[model samples]
Target: MSATKQHPFYKSLTVAVLLVWTAAVLYPLVWTLFGSLKDNQQFMLGKPWALPKFPLLWSNFSYVWETYGFSGYFLNSAIVAGASTLLSVLLAATTAYILARFAFKGSGTLLNLYLSAMMIPMILGLIPLFFLLNEMHLINKLVGLIIVYTASALPFGIFVLVGFFKTLPRELEEASAIDGAGYNRTFFTVMLPLAKSGLVSVGIMNALNIWNEYIMGTVFINDPSKYTLPVGIAIMQSEMQYRTEWGPLFAGLLLSMIPVIAVYVLFQRQIADGVTAGAVK
Candidate 1:
């Protein structure tokens, strides 16, 4: 084997950049984890970099989970994000499949419309959306939020999955057709499974967006009982000035991050594979 030809300067620079970025991202999470074990005073007054005192208060998580209603909010967010991701990704995959496979009048237009929808800042639709939802009697409802989240996530999902669908070998669909599979059957059983990587990629992204989304969540959900985690956390933070339990607040924040982290940990390989495959094609 040829001796490794190392570009020392470039290698050193790359390592330095990675180390800096890693530290920047990791420090805050570490600090937050440590702060969760202390009370408000220690978090505020004690050295910000120090570890928690000997008797780390694990009850802080329980307190945030129960006393502050994060449990309900967390569950509400899970339902909203989960439902929205599933519905949006399913719709997007079907839409993408048709656009990628079929050549017909206005198919391009339809795809273009979804692409254009991505450019329109969701904020621009807020006033009209509110009125429309209110007229539909969906204000402050979890179902309303689910629909809103699903719709908001659709365009991006379609954009990503369309590329994957286009990249798929046409022979797969041809074979499925020769086997007497209809369009729906071919799509659901063959094409869909083939595009699993891209679907998971978009689904995880949509879930993360829906989970962490604040503005739409805050606007649509008014009842505290129905609040999603981000909105609920903001509400809790606002109330914290009066209650002053910083440790449990940090605990709540940490809990909110677990889902996104877990998703990336579990499906990161598929996400990377989907991205590069879509890109190369």
Candidate 2:
């Protein structure tokens, strides 16, 4: 068979696969968007895939925001995730730099210890962690959540950043050192700027994870005002007894996803470049 003839079949196959994948990914989001515009009558009587005949868009969003306390939850989520991302990335960058650049007798063992931490399931540590937090009087607080999130995200961040830092040319640091630059100055001005893409990628991933975290948020935070979006949304679902407010619930769900999607879209290029750069070396 000619190359051109085979290419068309391969192209057709790729298109078909992509279409199916897109549908699978978008169906729930589309359904949720339409559902958020539907009233109870439409939700109960009509197909989920169908658009609402009478759009209650503003009403659904208003109800969710006003009644469900989504604003507070959203704010809490943002604070926790943002603080955690900042702290985790800073710590990871410093730690990864040391691990990547320095050679010590126990360096390999230390790296193994960090990797081992990743293998331990979070659930297994939940009980002890809860007790520890309680003893420290950090329960039901944003700071506590930030602490947990930073700790949880640190291992992966360090691993990824170490790999990225290792790929950086040693000559740059040597050149800086010869010009009277100290370790801190060289790292801050030279390595950090070069590693911006990788740091951003790690931060975005950590932020997304923390923002949508449920189990830790639920267990640690009992205060309604301190609840993150995921826990708050779940609470909203549970509060509905006689009839579910599908419209408002879906509206809240859609609204909650906005930040995550926006962050990904905004930093997508950096994330892509970071991953590619890391992989190349």
Best by lDDT, which number?
1
Each prediction's Cα lDDT score?
A: 0.89, 0.88
Give the poorly placed runs of model 2, Cα more than 4 Å off. Answer: 1-6
What tens-digit string does per-residue lDDT give for candidate 2 at 134-250?
Answer: 999999888888898899998888888888999889999999999999999999999999988899888888888888889999999999888899999999999997778888999
Candidate 1 per-residue C-alpha lDDT over 1-281 given as tens digits, one digit per residue, 9 for 90 to 100: 33343667767888999999999998998998998999877767757678899789899999999988998998999899989999999999999999998999999999999999999989888889999999999999999999998999999888888898897899998998999999999999989998888888888889888899999888877999999999988888888776678788889999999888899889899778876766565
* Clashing residue pairs, backbone N/CA/C < 3 A, model 1: none
Weakest ten-residue segment in model 2 by summed lDDT: 272-281
